[model samples]
Target: MRPALHAEEDVLLVVDPQPTFMALCPDELPVPGAEAVIPVINRILAGPIARAVVTQDWHHPRHLSFASQHPGKRPLETVDLPYGTQVLWPDHGVRATPGAAIHPALDQAKVVMILRKGFRQAIDSYSGFRENDRQTGTGLAEWLRAVGARRLFIAGITRPYCVDWTAEDAAAARFETWVVEDACARLGPDDALDASRARLEAQGIRFTTADTLHGENA
Candidate 1:
């Protein structure tokens, strides 16, 4: 028998599934497994999860966050911005681009809300709730609170970056958070996934599977 479903206050958060992120080099550090997670994400959305939210990494072409825009650094190189440590990225998706939009995995009509972040040219946003600095806001927390989302199951592109950040921040914000382990994939070696999971578990994020989450009601 499947495990019982959590209460209705829980939610499923799908982090950046944008085109640029999805097309990332499979051998890159964070491992963009956008396609791999689709089926798992779809099942969760198709299940009894009370709320579903997604975050998009929308950016501008000349966005200051890009390492190429800086001229002196390479992507993945860290630089100190006024906000703090920022990961310089290769130019990704623009808000207007269809690739940056949410994948067709979930029924759009079923999601309660879609939260987008990283519009600013100067900052990099890895977490759905906040940017890397932890000061600048995405306003996701307020929105989640308004919707009464206390439990979060997170999955999406680049397991080591945005997905990891979102789950950590959600747990830190006092939400009961879980990362669907098998639903996600990574670009780095096994070490990266292990380390990321360790940090999340330390912060109180539970490690789970979409199968279990979806079959809980079976």
Candidate 2:
């Protein structure tokens, strides 16, 4: 049986639903079908989800994670950073740019907070609760806990990266975590997404679709 979400205990987490990340954009890191998730997420917000939080990947121009900043490093090429292995990306989500802005299609009015990350120009932030260094905290956990948001319904773009990291952290933070599967898109192959799903399941993070959310009688 599927679990019921109580708005008092559960808050929707919309991750990186930006135009720059959509396949239609073609310039920034485009996750195929990313744009399609917005309406599903909006439907959830307008119905079962009364409270929400949104994340934006607000990067800086020439950010260290960008391949252009590192000579001879191509996008998606792996390299060692001071913190850990890093994935190089094309310049994206530059601060003050449209790519950095949340997609206007999203139901932003329902969101209680907007968390902007990856602005430091050195560290990358995929997890909404923590930076890539995994040491620096973003205070998302604290805010959620303080507000009594006990379960998290995470949705939005690039399921294998930002959404994946946020779900892992939410589980670690002891929130009953659920990933809205259809409300997410991916940048990589099916096997990569499969691997990420397996790991998240191992950590006890459950997955559901946006359809399930709206179909519920509750």
Candidate 3:
């Protein structure tokens, strides 16, 4: 018998797992066991999960999110923007760049939708629903609402940034949100991870693991 699904009212939201985002950075601490999470996501995608959605960071060559655009600036440096503080990324991940392409593990046939964000040069998008500042739009919220999704199960790369941001927003949107801890990785500081988790929890977002998605505890 299949183990109990950890959640019944959840839609899996896979954040940026593109090749560009997964390459190890020089200054950031590697996300603990993030590599192992890929297969887990694939398994969940193919499993009986209620639904699965993925996001791709599709940036223009001159995207403002890139440190390269702001010469002399470095990655992780926060700059004030119309939305708030924006984190400048070094010459690391560039979506659709051969290296930043989507992970092959995703079975597109199984995904209900693929939301592409960060296409604007001035706007840096992290969440699948809304851009930073909660003002910019992506139509993901409408899509989820149309699909009748009341809960979100989030996973994928860079736990502290993209995944964290998505989960926090989902909760703020009043959607039951959970971050599959084992299904994501982070390159931010340890403190950043803790802070991210704390903030999300404060918003009532649940933190879980892939084991919760499988049999019995599923």
Candidate 4:
């Protein structure tokens, strides 16, 4: 049987549903099929879930994660950073740009808070809870705790990175975390997504489809 999400005890987390991350737009880094997930996310938001939070990949024009900043290196190349293996990407999610804005299809009015991350010029932020440095937290966990959110339901663009990292961190923070699989798009290879699923499963994070939730809650 699927668990029911109580409004007061559960919070819906939308991770980086921005134009910069969607293939539907000609943004610097668009994830394939990212546009398709917006409707799925909206369906979840319109369901029984009440409170919600959204994360934005708000980066600086000269952010360290951009490949253009490093001469001779193109986007999608892997470079070792002080943190670990970092995938160099095109400059994206620059603050004040249209690409940084949330997808127009998303119901932003329903979100209680908008958490802007990756604004640090020197670091990259994948997890809504923390920077890639793994120590610099965005205080998402604290906010969730303060709001009395005991469980977290996550949905968004790019499954292998942001969504995966957020679920891992949320579980580590002692919240019952569940990822709505169909509500997310993968930016990496299938193997990467498979590995991420394994990692999340090991941490006890649950996975479900939007249809399952809608059927149970209906």
lDDT against the true structure, per candidate, is 0.75, 0.88, 0.74, 0.88
Ranked by lDDT, top first: 2, 4, 1, 3
RMSD to true structure for each model, in Å: 2.8, 1.2, 3.4, 1.4
Tens-digit per-residue lDDT, 50-120, candidate 4: 88899999998999899988899999897888888888898889998999998888987669989999999
Q: Tell me which of candidates 2 and 3 scores higher on lDDT.
A: 2
Candidate 4 at residue 63, lDDT? 93
For model 2, which pairs clash?
Answer: none
Candidate 1 differs from the real structure by a C-alpha RMSD in angstroms, to one decimal, of 2.8
After superposition on all CA atoms, how large is the RMSD of candidate 2? 1.2
Q: In model 3, state the lDDT of residue 108.
A: 62
Maximum-TM-score candidate: 2
**Which residue pairs show collisions in model 3?**
3-215, 3-216, 4-215, 4-216, 4-218, 5-218, 6-218, 20-99, 20-100
lDDT of 2 at 30: 83
Q: What tens digits encode model 3's per-residue C-alpha lDDT throughout 1-218?
A: 13344334558899876666543433322345555667888877766676788888888878787777776788778778888889887554455566556667666655778888888778888787788767887988778888788878899977788888888788778888889887888765889889879988888888877766654334
Could you tell which candidate, 3 or 4, scores higher by TM-score?
A: 4
lDDT of 1: 0.75
**Model 3 vs truth, CA RMSD:** 3.4
Tens-place lDDT digits, model 1, residues 142-194: 88888777788887776787889888888878888888877665656789878
- Name the regions of candidate 3 deviating beyond 4 angstroms: 1-9, 24-34, 92-95
